[model samples]
Target: MSTLVQLVLAMLTGGAFSTIVHAVMNRRRSNAEAAQIIAEAAASLVGPLNERLGQHEQRIQVLEAENAHKTTLLDEAIGFIRDLLAWAGRLLPGERTPDIPDTLRDELQL
Candidate 1:
């Protein structure tokens, strides 16, 4: 009877040990899968955000270049208009508008 009881105890202990080990292995596998999923999600999100950020930077550069060109053009136009107005003011009231002044052509950087 004692031997029979020992046998049953031994079987239960072996089953319990195997169950614990199996549970631990399953948990490890699940954790690895979770980590992989997290890494993939991060990579996916980062890839597009990085691409968009690059595109935005390029767009900003283009806009800045356009602004500079516009500013230069506006400055030239303002300078020309000011010179023309000053030259016109110098004319006699009834004088026909004179030919475009040499000073204006000379001063124009274009």
Candidate 2:
């Protein structure tokens, strides 16, 4: 081959190789930057989500405490009414309030 023709061929090959390498490097850098941005977005959301979860837990505990208190009050009221029924049964045996069976009344502690 002529020297000038060989030189032109070499220049073309070098230019093509340089272009391919640059494209590969640019794609890799872009991918890395995208991954970093996603990580940052996730980190920013973590604090607010954790705080909301903690607040919900505290509210659930408060509601549970109030429900327990109400349950105790209801239990006391039921016991008082049961005692009143037992006393009435004893004091008014002749009045015929209802035909409650003796075994059932004993089971109820009446």
Query: lDDT tens digits, residues 26-82, model 1?
Result: 799999999999999999999999999999999999999999999999788869777
CA lDDT of every candidate: 0.76, 0.76
Off by over 4 Å in 2: 1-13, 92-110
Error of model 1, residue 91, in angstroms: 2.0
Clashing pairs in 1: none
Badly placed stretches (over 4 Å) of model 1 are: 1-13, 92-110
- The sequence of per-residue lDDT tens digits that candidate 2 reaches over residues 2-32 is 4565457558787575556566767998999
Look at candidate 1 and tell me the lDDT of residue 98.
Answer: 48
- In order of appearance, the predictions have TM-scores of 0.63, 0.63
